[model samples]
Target: MIKLFLPLCILFLMSGCKKSELEAVNSSPTVSADKAVEVAAYEVEAPTPPKEISQKLLPDVNQSAQPPITPKKIDTIAKKIIKNGNMKIQVGDIKKAQTQVGDILKKNNAYIQSEQFQNTDVDDNLDLVIRVPHKNFDALVNSFSDGVGSVLSKNISSDDVTEEYTDVSIKLANKKIYLEKYRDMLRSASTTKDMIEIQETIRELEDEIDLAEGRLRLIDDRVNYSTLNLSLYKEKVRSSATSKIGFGSRFADSVTQGWNSFMSFLLGIISLWPFLLIIPILIFLWRKWKSGRTKP
Candidate 1:
């Protein structure tokens, strides 16, 4: 009976050892799971930068570091100027002065646009309208003032037409654009009313364009060529009777005049012959009456 009790106690000790080993294994698994959960939570809370976000920011930084681009500037146009002048000069001889003026014009590359001449008892005048290149305008005026004759009056004027020219040019371009559009519309018009309206608009635009072009042409002409109104004047010298005559000539003229006076007196006596005969008849009658009275 002692031996049996000893074997039963040994078996009980073995079973208790197995139970402790099983509990240790179960606790290890629970600790491993808790470690895994903590690791996952740590990963979730930690911060990480994405390469795509860095790339996007890098482009923005590079762009900010680069220089800014500026817009290009447009070129400026030339100025438009119109010049005009009026001058009056006193000359010695009109014909000779006219010839001299012609020579000067040829030298200056100018021409007489119009010319007029007047001769009077008091003076002679030669009026000329001269057109000269803009560059040569002042030179021509100086030449005429210094060489041609004495200047009586001079007037010079300059007009700045740059603004007007620019405005007209822009308006003309716009009108041409509208005109083209109208023509295209007219071509594609499906109805008579639309065609007629487009045609009318086109006509109006064409007229405006023509007028603007003509004005520009006129302005260009005035700017390129300066106009000058030139007047040449010469005073006449009158002849005097009291001056510069030889004694012999004066004596001859006086003798001729005296002879004319004597002839006129003789003709007057011939015209009175009828009156002389009547006087004689009256004298005879008077004497007869006196004798008759004395006898009575």
Candidate 2:
């Protein structure tokens, strides 16, 4: 019993020592300073940044008074915020106003998602539909309204899509987890049938993930830009503002049109004069002889 106890105790101590050694050697896989050189490009093979670049790129890296950021850690976080809003604008001189809006959009470096412009003859009106990128949309629109000669009507609308966006994001994350689990299952599947089932489940998860991603993209695009449905018109100059033409002017126009028609009719008669001449001359001679016989 003593002999077995001695061997077992030694074995346990050896196993414990081995476990500690493994743990000490196998550290967690945080991105190292070397791997952060090209961090913006998302590469993992970067080396330690130079003192100058590190100071320039990451000023707070060595700050203990402030929140400390290690040289090896990710430098700064990137965040994207999305919101959807729209506007309705009524302005005078639609064409000129649209041109101004275009200039504003360009100045703001906004992407034109879509545009539609229509001119109406039924009434003196033009309709314009414009979608500008989300980032500078509100500011750009504000600047635009300032230049509008007179805003006959204006309206603004908004949709709070934050909750929906967050929902899809979380759902997509879970689907990725599920997809990874299914992928693992596929790799370790025993039977062919089991492998096929796992793959099928993975496919479903991928489809769901894709759908969620598409929705997210749509939300991102819509939120980034504001849509403006603008209606504007160039007012017609009414006849009351102008004096009527004098008698001389009226007579001249009448004479011009009448002379044109008369010339046209004379040319038509001359063209058929040969045929008319023969018929008229023959009738005249017959009447002359009849008159001469009656005189005798």
Tell me the tens digit of each residue's lDDT in model 1 across 107-190.
Answer: 889999999989898899999999999999999999999988899999999999999999999999899999999988888999
- RMSD of every candidate to native, in Å, equals 17.4, 25.8
Q: Please give, for residues 31-105, the per-residue lDDT of candidate 2 as tens digits.
A: 454455557556555577897787677656455456655577543322445444445555556677778867876
- Evaluate all candidate structures by whole-model CA lDDT and list the values in order: 0.93, 0.72
- Each model's number of backbone clashes? 0, 6
- In terms of TM-score, the best-performing candidate is 1
The list of candidate 1 runs beyond 4 A from truth reads 1-75, 241-296
* TM-score for each predicted model, relative to the true structure: 0.59, 0.48
Predicted structure 1: lDDT: 0.93
Highest lDDT: which candidate?
1
